[model samples]
Target: MGLAIGWTDAGIARLLLPGDTPADMRQRLGQAGGSEKHDGQPELAARIAAYSEGARDSFRDITLDLDGVPEMNRRIYRHIRELEWGETTTYGAIARWLGDVAMSRAVGAAMGANPIPLIVPCHRVLAADGRTGGFSSPRGVRAKMEMLALEKAASPNGQFSFGF
Candidate 1:
């Protein structure tokens, strides 16, 4: 299946198709590339900032721009993308969810491989030590830390802990 993508509205936390058009989704993500255009392209910027704000109503309704993803990473990332805005699961947790053992590191690698960090929310994952985990964005750990804080305040899964 093609990559199914959507967005969360930080202003009102919920996930939805931007235009309710599946064809549009296929067209956008069908041959997409890096995160460069995503960083500030109208709808793209809104989605990224919504998640970054850690607001509870993130996905209440928004548009998704999924396009190009490799099969391997897609297998892992599709599940990762479903992670709620404020909730987090560990690398180890994601591996087990994939029905695999000893693949926690591989899960971490998968998270890092996400082209759409804020959208896929790789920042929601963490090291076992409860520290903000790595993110592929240029902001590095700084971005991770801020994201954790944002979610901590509005998480429905309030189970995550970050050492800051």
Candidate 2:
């Protein structure tokens, strides 16, 4: 499976998995951009492919076009985007970091609304008391747990392993 990235002269507008067509993702996210074939940016596609294959430790320094996302959700995503590989944070913690402990569900909503899945790393967000929380991606929590396992497997000392 390959990655499809929507872009304009500005930057990457949206990122989607091979399961959905770029046209579908653009329409779903209300994004504005022309899509280039995977060959157009072989390096990026390769990086994404490597990550999907569970051969890469982390996706570093990738840019996303978040212009269409809501402001509150943007704020929440910004905080978790910095989460290092093999690390996870709770929805409640993120809501608290945003200065409203009561926004835990709101945080969950933002995670569900996340358009750029792996790039934004929404799987790294968990439920309170270390639950798996919910995942909007295909395969749901299984996908999230698989990603966590991939990272855990690649970690230097396996310190990332945390039982649920």
Candidate 3:
């Protein structure tokens, strides 16, 4: 199972879930050493609306606070947060990064299980062949592609690097 939790912030219920891991994900959120005051639920809802309306940067840093994920999910999400914006990595590359060279599917599964999708930047994780894979949660998959495109265009590489 993936991780993270959501509370009604401005009526839009924000979730910060990531992939699963062996550790207690919820506990980790409590220990993340960061928190931000929500302007209110309406603002949060607006942000969600913007995100759905094709706003890639329309995300809050607080989304990293997954309070209900497993260890694997945390591991995957932590890695994702390391992304420097305007860049991407592959599921296979992530699996290799975690030393789970044989766990590409698991990496995909973890991504699928991500709760806080855009915030964790799961869309940044693409297929090995440069294809954008499945985005399990709500919102359009094409938007994910668009987000990657945005990042690619903004990145200095002129193309995103997986660091593989």
Best by TM-score: 2
Model 1's alpha-carbon lDDT is 0.55
Candidate 2 lDDT, tens digit per residue, 1-164? 64466655555656665545656655644543454444555677778778777675455477667887899998887788888887888888898899989999999999998877888888888866566778776557777878888877233332433444
TM-score list, all predictions: 0.60, 0.77, 0.61
Misplaced by over 4 Å in model 3 are 1-5, 8-60, 153-164
Most accurate candidate by lDDT = 2
In model 1, the runs with Cα more than 4 Å from the true position are: 1-41, 50-54, 57-68, 153-164
lDDT of all predictions: 0.55, 0.72, 0.61
* True-structure RMSD, every candidate: 9.9, 4.5, 9.7
Tell me model 3's lDDT, rounded to 2 decimals.
Answer: 0.61
How many clashing residue pairs are found in candidate 3? 16
* Candidate 2, superposed: residue stretches over 4 Å from native: 18-39, 153-164
lDDT tens digits, residues 1-164, model 1? Answer: 11233333322121222332556554544444221122234564455556444445444243444444466566776676677756777777778887885888888887776756555667777766565556665447676767667766333244344453
Model 3, TM vs. native: 0.61
